[model samples]
Target chain A: MKLTTTKRLERLNERYANGDISRRSFLTLTAAAAAATGLSMPWMGRALAAVSEVRFDGWGGVVQEAIDKYAFQPYTAKSKVKVVQGTFGDENEIITKIKTSKPGDFQIVHSSGVNYYIKYVNGGFNSEINEANIPNMANVLTAMIEPFRKITPKLSAVPYDYGTTGIAYNNKVISPEEAKEKGANLLTDTKYAGKIGGYADMTTRVWYAALQTKQDPNSIQDMDAVWAKVRETRDLAKKFWSSGAELMDLLSRNEIVVTDAWSGRVAALQQQGQPIGYLDPAGSYAWMEDMLVLKGSPMAECEELINFMLDPATSIAVAEGQNYPPSLDPTKVKLTDKIAALPAFDPTGSMKSLTFADPLYWAKNEDAWTKQWDRVSKGA
Target chain B: MTKGWKLYDQRLAWILVAPVLLLLILLLLLPIAMMTVYTFFTFVTAGVESAVLTFDNWKEFLTDSYYHGFLWKTVRVGAITAVICAILGYFPAYFIWATTFRHKWLLLLLLIVPFWISFTIRTFSWIHILGEQGLINVVLIRLGVISEPLPMLYTEGAVIMGLLHFLLPYMILNVYVSLESIDRTLIAAARSMGCTSAQAFREVTLPLSMPGLGAGLLLCFVLAAGSYVTPQLLGGSRDALFGNLIYDTIMGQLNWPMGATLSIVLFVLLGAAAAAYSRYMGLSQIMKGLSA
Candidate 1:
């Protein structure tokens, strides 16, 4: 009787290994062996899927479409779990949704900026990540993950893409040498008066402005005199841009000659022969977008999805579609001449001039920066 | 006839109107109540809403000179836009009414057809007309009438132009309805009673058309005061409106308490002005302009 049982169990195990049966049936079949051998484990998946669906609240429009096509679709094909997507972005709106929602309502979110969205981590909406589930996390570029890990709780989120925040200019109006000479201080130079475009949010803009006058941007406590310097730039600006898209529109129309903008946008326009060039003004600050698993999420599946997103092929597809630098090594994904020409599409190259912004440090002074920008820079 | 029967009829009447009453309570009163409650709460960083009640938001607005400047700017813009609309709208309306042309409907159609296109699109069109390298400036520069393109956009003049263009239709419609409704025979009677054409208009036509004129003024003022987009898109650097301030506090700064306070203050002031208008002129007259 014992010999027959061993042969029967071995055949059942072979069928399970060959993907003939669900994990649930395999567990039931192995219940007797498991009672004898103690094989219960955390890494094991359920019969069909761990969860019925994983809700992903991410930025809407083309970015979400790219994530769905390259990341969500591929994972869903393999895992057989449904993916329910919701749009959540624009820092305040995302914070409000997570704060109001019950724990684990959303399993994943494409967090745009860790510096701005770290409050959600502090609020405990996102907490744990298991390195074992995500074997591919190590394959991704360290520079992509290192800075965010420094500011956040260890391994709270993993980065997906990064870009430099610096000055973009119409080469027709300002020469490349001129932009380099002025660097970030070009905003207040007065030569570009009524032509400079200012960013509405000062996280990127303040860093540039502080570095101009030789103040430690990372250590500003009270910017008592910084306002006077900021005001110089504000006086030169015709209008402040609310988004990268809006700033890009102004550039396209020649409505603005010089502006602080994202590197990707300038690269895209330059590729189209728009006579645009992007400069890393005084060693540019790198802004990384990340994927954070929510607190109480199905750990195994969420980690699987994030790991899938970091796969070289998937990361490359996302980089091409979304105009972000692939988080993996530049050589992992072969780029066409058109894509190779764009600076931000290459991971190692983007890192050449881009430095990780200290979010934890920036988080402390973000509100002060906002207040000063509103009250003083805008001359409220 | 009987008291019990009368009570039953009253109950039936309320039952018939219950949907509208419920909608008003839900959509209007509930939101205002929630807004009022928010003004008392404290807003912290990262969109945190604290249950602790305080008047700090209101106190800040009342004390801040920055807010004062915005409030003052909103009122001035509203008043100026309304006055300009009323002035420009009356001439077209009067022309349509006075014309004996067979295609008077065609003339009125020309006035109202532009409104069929989106007002936002119409406002944006002003950009191409008024931008630095815009049509007018380009033409002027080619003609050598000016050395450089005029600073036509992002100014107070641009904002007024946008508001005036949008609100003109409303003003014209209201004034036309008032002019059309007036009995032509009354003016004839005034002229027969030893009055000139101008005198007849002053005595009979002008006084009689005051209801529509008043309604148009108040409606224009209310909408212009609460507008955010026109100033943001068209106005200069110093042209931030009250609505912009409220929006900035809520969306940009994530300070809901401050935003709610600004909204309530604006609502109460506008509500008071509307109420005064209703009391001085009849409510029916004001509503007629909106429906028109």
Candidate 2:
């Protein structure tokens, strides 16, 4: 029920447009409101200072390009506030940069969801967001918001989009039938030795390994079997791509014929007429991405920006362009055909069909597993 | 008045040197001291650490064989690269020194051309040349060579090749400066005193250029050993150098304390190499080559 300053101002404007007050009264009230807010707090001067630009860091690829084209550009045009952007191939790389930087140096992040949310929370880099500012949050799937809410009841981030990390194969070498039948096992197939690739990430590697070993990723047992399966895939892989762009490069150049690839990136490749076939095998790793406003950000402006991004038209356009489904509840807001057809799109809006990594379960094992996986990927 | 002027000259000399000395302390020594302190800090979780001083990070580094293996491999790779650079770079340095061709500076200009392009782009160019559907494979398959595309990229060899590409010019420049400084009369004297061309070259030219070659070797070795990008781009996971390990520890693992420990190890090892070079070959020769 806490209203953002923007929402309060918006209501004032609405009343004014409806002739609820005289011109002098409206002007007097506006000035009084501004003075009260600005002079009320010692630190409010910096916080309420006109934010001309919002600094945003994100994954630099087609995904970010879509966000820029569909959301950021339009918002900037409407609001006249520029969005300064930076990119990181890996989330942890940006985390390190943020650690070395001062509080307000970085503002918003296109963060990988709850799994990374824990890291931010632990690092004390999280900021409480006033949800009433983002009215569009009403349309976002409750299932997507729950995970983040579970970590911090007062959410610091809003789930924006979701996708699957599934098996992408070159259709020229692998038939759709073969890909469907083999599923996650295709990554470890000896036939594709020296032509195989995988994501060089702990969660993705361990998740696939869990699937291959017939263990649930959320409650993985038989750690040895999981490690063995991971090693099996590692020994056969030609390379372990670390970024989405690198994944596309390897696949397009045929440096790798089979690999675990992001569904959105594979969809992009298909759109470009690449002979790529994508499938979300049973227990494929699913993840959600969020717009995380970090500590010491321009809160009202960032909340307003998040609100703008979540507008159904903008969200849907970004989803279609990025080939990821919007976190907008499909049952609430109508979606385009392109979004429904996009990989990992769930019509029911329950999100139960996709097997997202349990934030608590994964966060608990991240440090140990990540260290072990790093060594394993390096021929340990 | 003359004595006072002499005293003023000494103060002027100190004033001229103070800025550089202060810069070195601030930029180099202070950061190293901070990292050394961080090496003792406890790593609680990824991206979270405590200032509670402990010897655990250093203890782990010293006790672990995994770190040692990577460090040794990095040194070995660096040594191999230096030796190869010395062999491949000598003739080019000798060519520029011995050439009577007009526009000698143009040859040196060719060496400087690669710097105009981005180092990352130069490394990425190898992908098109070495990938499966790349130029090498297409041409070889067309000409009825072995059917399979040679697995040339992302190997240790590719990494070494990338390093060589980057560091070769340094080697050539260093050796060239050494060769240029050689007195032509010394070689002429040896040649005139019943020595053949090859013998004169070995006795006079090669020995005189040793300081430059030695300097180049040390420079190439340090740069190659400390390389992070080339191996990350061109080498397979197993082919990662100590620098990559440090990167993984700090950035990937978010274990900055251990990363700091690894960094200090590399710094100390490289510093030792420089000290050893200074002991055997006067460090001033390296200075002369670099200045020229």
Clashes of each: 0, 0
Candidate 1: stretches off by over 4 Å = A1-90, A93-109, A122-133, A146-156, A293-305, A329-353, B1-13, B101-115
CAPRI class assigned to model 2: medium
Best by DockQ: 2
lDDT tens digits by residue: candidate 1, A117-155: 566665666756766667778666676676667666457
- Superposed on all Cα atoms, model 1 deviates from the true structure by an RMSD in Å of 7.6
For each candidate, give its TM-score against the true structure: 0.84, 0.93
The DockQ-derived docking category for candidate 1 is acceptable
Across B1-292, the per-residue lDDT of candidate 1 in tens digits comes to: 7656675597878988999999999999999999999999987674656879999998999998888888888889999999998899888888889999998889878878887999788888998999877899999999999987788787888998999988888888888888888999999999999999999989998889887888888888888999989987887657778887787677666677888999998998788768888898876775565565
lDDT for each residue of candidate 2 in B1-292, tens digit (9 for 90 to 100): 5655675597878988999999999999999999999999999999999999999998998998888999999999999999999999999999998999999999999999999999999999887887778788889999999788899888999999999999999899899999998999999999899899999999999999999999999999999999999999999988999999999999988999989999999999999999999999978877876676
Model 1, position A216, has a per-residue lDDT of: 69
In candidate 2, position B274 carries an lDDT of 94
RMSD of each: 7.6, 5.2
Worst-scoring 10-residue span by lDDT in model 1 chain A: A40-49
TM-score of chain A of each: 0.76, 0.89
DockQ of 1: 0.27
